[model samples]
Target: MSEETTRGRAAVSGVAWRRRWRVPEKYRTKGTARPEGGGRSAGGDAPAPIRQWPLLLVLATTLVGLVVTLADFRIGLLIVGGALLTGAVLRAWLPAVGMLAVRSRFTDVVTYAVLGTAVVLLTLMAEPRPWLEVPFLSDILRFSVD
Candidate 1:
């Protein structure tokens, strides 16, 4: 390809990337934060920062699971697994996930669902007694213990 054509392609790609990932201009200025209403407002009426409620709920669930771990490992596993699965569902279905919407929607959904599934499977086969048997996972777990 000619140098001029390559440069033109690069410029076009750059514009696409910026449009996809750049923070909105309203969010750029610290002094004029966009309120929940999502419009520019005078300093006197600036709205509160938008909170990522789904992310907060996930964090709370995980913390509760950690606390429960002190009493019973299996129950803790169940709690954490449920939390992760809930997160996956939210990420997959919600149009706007607030701060939790980090990457592209498809990527985020896949990541959440995969991680949640793994956690659920591991929890079911966790120690104190395996609730579901996966031959490969059992072999790996035994190998690690030995």
Candidate 2:
């Protein structure tokens, strides 16, 4: 082919190359960037006007449990319901800790566990099932026969 024709073909190919995306050198191996914020980068960074989602989930779950309890619900509802109450309480208190600059995920987990335990204890105490009883196994009786 003549020089002019060759140059034209090359130019066309270069344009086509540009049209196709080329991975930048930096991202050739690794993945996406972490959020640029200091602590707990929001999956969504809109001003959360009300309770955070974890808190809300907890609240919803808890409310469901309460409904079940009133409607003569099941054990799952009670357990999950107690959990939700714990969550609501955590939602209330977590931000307070965060205000002191301890907003790490670990702290969040520990707080949730402790609060959830308390909630469970309170619920058990609040009202217990009539049929639920601690069984004493009489089969293996230990008597001070001496």
Candidate 3:
């Protein structure tokens, strides 16, 4: 094809691509979807860290749990679970939890609660002691394996 025709076709293709991938009005307005409950944990006048206290708290607790994990696996797991549970509680109770609000209030709460509970339960059921054994779980495992 001629150079002019090639350039014309390329321009048309680019236009078509742009139209195909055009962002919606809502997304174009903000360019990002802020989490449903994500608002400043503290006042607007507060510093960035203070405003994001909930997220910082959760991250700090998780970090502590990770550090503890290096020394005591079970205890560390419990701490991690506690941290997640704390996040759930904070998300549920607080109207504006800054970065801690990853989704809608209900969704974030449910996710945190479920994950925290699972972690704690699994930790309790760790081998050599099995603090929170469920008799049916063993039966189910055996049935599935068999």
Highest lDDT: which candidate?
3
Candidate 3 yields a Cα-based lDDT of 0.93
Give a tens-digit lDDT track for model 1, residues 36-136.
22221123243333345667777789899989988988788678878877877877776555656656666766777778778878878876678988898
- Cα lDDT, all candidates: 0.72, 0.52, 0.93
- Each model's number of backbone clashes? 0, 0, 0
The C-alpha RMSD of each candidate to the native structure, in angstroms, is 11.6, 18.4, 3.2
Model 2, residue 28: what's the lDDT? 85
TM-score of each: 0.58, 0.34, 0.79
lDDT of 3 by residue, 85-133 (tens): 9999999999899999888899999999999999999999898888889
Residue 53's lDDT in candidate 1: 67
- Decide which is better by lDDT, 2 or 3: 3
Q: Encode model 2's per-residue lDDT on 1-146: one tens digit a residue.
A: 99999999999999899878787888786775432222332334545523244545565776777766776645545666467446545544544322122244455456666666655544554434533332342223334332
**In candidate 2, which residue pairs get closer than 3 Å at backbone N, Cα or C atoms, i.e. clash?**
none
lDDT of 2 at 18: 89
Clash count for candidate 1 is 0
Clashing pairs in 3: none
